[model samples]
Target: MVSQLDNPNLNLIPKPSHTVKGLIHIFTTAHRNFFTDVMAQALRIAGQGTPVLVVQFLKGGIRQGYKNPTQLSQKLDWIRCDLPRCIDTPHLDDSETASLRDLWEYTQKVVTEDRYSLVVLDELSLAINFGLIPEIEVLEFLAKRPPHIDVIFTGSETPKSILDMADQITEIRRSHTP
Candidate 1:
């Protein structure tokens, strides 16, 4: 009456012994699947009250097709909050700006209050392109996060500065010209 879970031949990846205090991981396409798997595991741990935050840097038009691997959408009950994407830009009128500001303020309040077990920032680099904040500034913000918080940064072509700050670096490279 033995089960697969009790099989001695199985090799189970070790989980974090205790809740993660602080961790920073940088990964590229060559290691995308491994990185994704690790993130999924961390999210599972975070769901058990580890205080997790995920900041994904997707190229413009990329994230629209992606789905949350951890089922965080259901776990966090996240609602989309649109920002101005710029201040006084010709495209957005004062009314639009005001609305965007209000949305931004509301979202920040929810995040700071820990309303969700996880917060997903999809395609944040696209917003960075709008000059909302410098890439390094975001990294600094992440580094200064409270020890109880578990922050995950995911992107394709991450800035070198941010990558340097990461504790774990996984580079997934594919040969393009062979």
Candidate 2:
């Protein structure tokens, strides 16, 4: 048989176009202070001129709402619930509940608008576990979000469904020193 390398039509083959698709990343830890790495990543990406949105579902006390996002840079926006204090338990007052619902709705709206390259949902798992946000809604949101937008979920005790859906999972464990 003749060598295939001698074929003259090899150069005429059309190359297939490849598109870049974003991935779902999950960062989990048993402690609350394990998100420094995630924050650093968000800042780094924003510093590189890519749009990033960080939403703190359970963090509050600053009265920062969706409309009053703190702009860390030209490309980064951080938003928190409009509560008077941080959420540590499932029980919430009517006003606090309303605030969280509003924030969740706003997050879905802006994420659907395809305005950011990376979106970080901080303490989202905790919110879900607390029943503040519906897990079904979150799954639906993930399904309907733009395919090119990368999403990062940070919290402890992440749901199995969300963990299974993640393309990459990072678990941080602290080593106790005696």
Tens digit per residue, CA lDDT, model 1, 1-178: 8755666645576767876565565545523344456457656756676544443332212221122222353343322323323232325556544543444345345555655444445434344555544666566566555544444454455666776776776655666655
Q: Best-fitting candidate, measured by TM-score? A: 2
TM-score of 1: 0.47
lDDT of 2 at 51: 99
Superposed model 2: Cα runs more than 4 Å off: 1-18
Residue range 1-178, candidate 2, lDDT tens digits: 7755667788889887764788899999988887788989999999999999999999999999998999999999999999889999999999999999999999999989999989999999999999999999999999999988999999998999999889999988878955
Off by over 4 Å in 1: 1-20, 30-39, 54-121, 129-132, 173-178
How many backbone clashes can be found in candidate 2? Answer: 0
Query: lDDT of candidate 2 vs native?
Result: 0.93
Q: Name the lDDT value of residue 176 in candidate 2.
A: 90
What is the TM-score (0 to 1) of candidate 2? Answer: 0.89
